[model samples]
Target: MLRFCPLSRIDGQKTFVIMERKGDKGNGKQTQKRIAPPQYDEAFKAGAIRMVTEQGRPSTEVAKELGICIDTLRSWLKAAGVQAGQADRQNRDSRRTRELEAEVRALRKQQAEKDEVIDVLKKSVGILSRP
Candidate 1:
């Protein structure tokens, strides 16, 4: 005998529901906490739309990546004042260029560290091999 329940109102506002098993005794144990309902946000929706359209990611995948549901992604796409398949390509291109530049910088830094290590090893080898 499972029962669906609603939140209790306290001070004119709803509070979280705590459910107890039907066959359980009134021993103040075996309680399950209710998860809060989802709330809508405009910015989240816009960002989801942007990720889907601009980043060329699917809505379902983007929703999962963003920790939101597919329905939530749809709602956001509706709210973002943009279509699902329309993204600013120039913006994405520029962003990709920046990302590539940053990656190159990181690789250059790593190469410099490796070069320093090689120089030290070379100096050590020369000293050890000298007459």
Candidate 2:
């Protein structure tokens, strides 16, 4: 699970910035990390997509045989306007994950608001007798 932190407020204005928690160095500086791009050329990508589109091979099997990630293979196929059974399923799963994450964030914010209300009520009811 990726943990996201809210950005610090500057000048009393809230700004939104989303960053991945993965590969964090934990020393106050956050830097993005990237892997070396694969050496697959245009012809190679076309050939890989052909293996699935024309050969009717399953994307999973084709990716495994080609030593590439299923998502990468599917992306290449999609960009080439090739539709595979896995593409739809992958899109739905990606959308669902995003929806769930958004829901979690909304729920957390609501819970925080309720906590603030409860604290205010407790203070008004003399739960803490301040000097």
Candidate 3:
């Protein structure tokens, strides 16, 4: 008479998994399997902050939507140089501002020159009329 010990069987599968008996005391040990965790990216955190700020979504809502903690979103915002209720300083000024300022100064100088010419013309007319 022979005794067979079965370990596991998959459903509808014609395969049998068996574990061998070991040791003088009849103790058997199974091998352990290892699983690796997923990798995280800081870019995802930055994207979450952009979504919340640019989309005008609430912090808690954005965190829930992204399946992350609210604190993580806050930290991401800090890293991206954005503050709550404050404009992003990095994007506040640009070459366009400098161009606009230069344009305004040039227009003011042109107007000042025109004003001086008009004053001279008026003085000549007044002098001619007095004679």
Query: What does the lDDT come to for candidate 3?
Result: 0.62
Model 2 superposed RMSD (Cα): 26.7
With a 3 Å backbone cut-off (N, CA, C), the pairs that clash in candidate 2 are none
TM-score quality measure for candidate 2: 0.39
Q: How far off is residue 115 in model 1, in Å?
A: 43
For model 1, the superposed segments whose C-alpha errors exceed 4 Å read 1-15, 18-32, 81-131
Q: How far out, in Å, is residue 14 in model 1?
A: 8.9
Flag the better candidate by TM-score, 2 or 3: 2
Q: Candidate 1: minimum summed lDDT over ten consecutive residues — where?
A: 82-91
lDDT of 1 at 110: 100
TM-score for model 3?
A: 0.34
lDDT of 2 by residue, 1-131 (tens): 23434454545444444454656546465533333445578988989888776655678888999898988988897898877776545555666888999999999999999999999999888955766
Q: Residue 113 error for model 3, in Å?
A: 53
Best by lDDT: 2
Candidate rank order under lDDT: 2, 1, 3
